[model samples]
Target: MPRRCATRNDLMKPGYVYIMTNKNNTTLYVGVTSDLERRVKEHKSKKDPKSFTARYNLNKLVYHEAHQMIGDAIAREKQLKAGNRAKKMALIESINPEWQDLIIGDE
Candidate 1:
């Protein structure tokens, strides 16, 4: 049987798309995860020393958005990643003027 492509409605797992940055807000990382809190914790703990987030110390959750389906979150993450740094910064600033960590007191 031929494989079938998955439709948007087929991807129903809830997920979150988040933007993380370093303390100085000089770097930005976009990620999509089924478990936002757990993922953030992993980043904070430097679960993968060689990972981009860990290498850049981008553990601060500057922005995040939730979707009804994981696929949507993944798509959003890709779009954010493909965009320019100025666009990303503008998006972050729209919600976080000071670029403050959205997930505070977790450390």
Candidate 2:
């Protein structure tokens, strides 16, 4: 399973990546999708018929990446998801130390 991201023109394409944060911002979940904004909205609104995000209330957008192909994005996502929380935090810090939700552009 893979995900998508929202980065300007890359919004509806595969190979996109994203990271979500909890209200306290302690819990982080990395994902990749072709439609980051739409996907995030789904989680935020619990639109999906069945979803892990809705169950955990993990709707805060923290980070994201857009790619030209789904395979590349999936590979990167798998790598990040397989790592520990420390590694994931490091990855986010390296690119977004502020930990702000990049998904703000849509809202």
Candidate 3:
């Protein structure tokens, strides 16, 4: 057997399931994106001012997970969205106890 090195192209394309919250963590938004950095930037910039996220000021990225498949990411997003506030909070706290913004420097 021979050792093999991983190449950029050989790596699986990643999709992201992310949670964004308001300044006070009063609101939460779960979403999936192939490009988490760009999506988070859009949210922060209020790209769609009329959108619910913009209206709710849900621009603070609190938590995120990466998936090898987009379908899995979408499914996770759906699951998170369908969950109650307590469940979502638990998920965030598990990885980000302080609910810190995760999108920083992601761009």
Candidate 4:
């Protein structure tokens, strides 16, 4: 569980805790940062040209947890990253059984 900040009413700081899966759904990537839009855009565009995400085609924004503080988001990302692949798949599956690539929940 994440430690609650002493402050309440956390503002949306544009940070995102996100997960990505390979085309065959055999791989997963967990990450967090302050720029959800730009980061997801890069992944979808394969902008890095040679990144782990791009190499694996892990561009689907399958699961995400928005946070007000980067610290909280990072912590959550780390937790998810340390989990087993089955656990990770289950997490995404619970929210999106069809593995819908819900970028920013625009759909």
lDDT of each: 0.91, 0.75, 0.87, 0.79
Candidate 1 lDDT, 1-107, residue by residue in tens: 69687666667879999999998889889999889999999999998999999999988999999999999898999999999999999999999999888886466
lDDT of 4 by residue, 1-107 (tens): 69776343343354689888766777788988678877888888887878999889887888887887776887788888888988888888898999988874331
lDDT of 3: 0.87
| Candidate 2 to native Cα RMSD, angstroms | 5.9
Query: Which stretches in model 2 have alpha-carbon errors above 4 Å?
Result: 1-13, 105-107
Candidate 2 structure quality by residue, lDDT tens digits, 4-101: 55465553356678888877777777888767778888777877647677666777777777778777787889988899998888877888888876
Clashing pairs in 2: 3-32, 3-33, 4-32, 4-33, 4-34, 5-33
Q: Can you tell me which runs of candidate 1 are displaced by over 4 Å?
A: 1-10
* Candidate number of the best TM-score: 1
Predicted structure 4: lDDT: 0.79
Instruction: Find the candidate with the highest lDDT and give its number.
Output: 1
Candidate 4, residue 66: Cα displacement in angstroms equals 1.0
In candidate 1, where is summed lDDT lowest over 10 consecutive residues? 3-12
Order the candidates by lDDT, highest first — what do you get? 1, 3, 4, 2
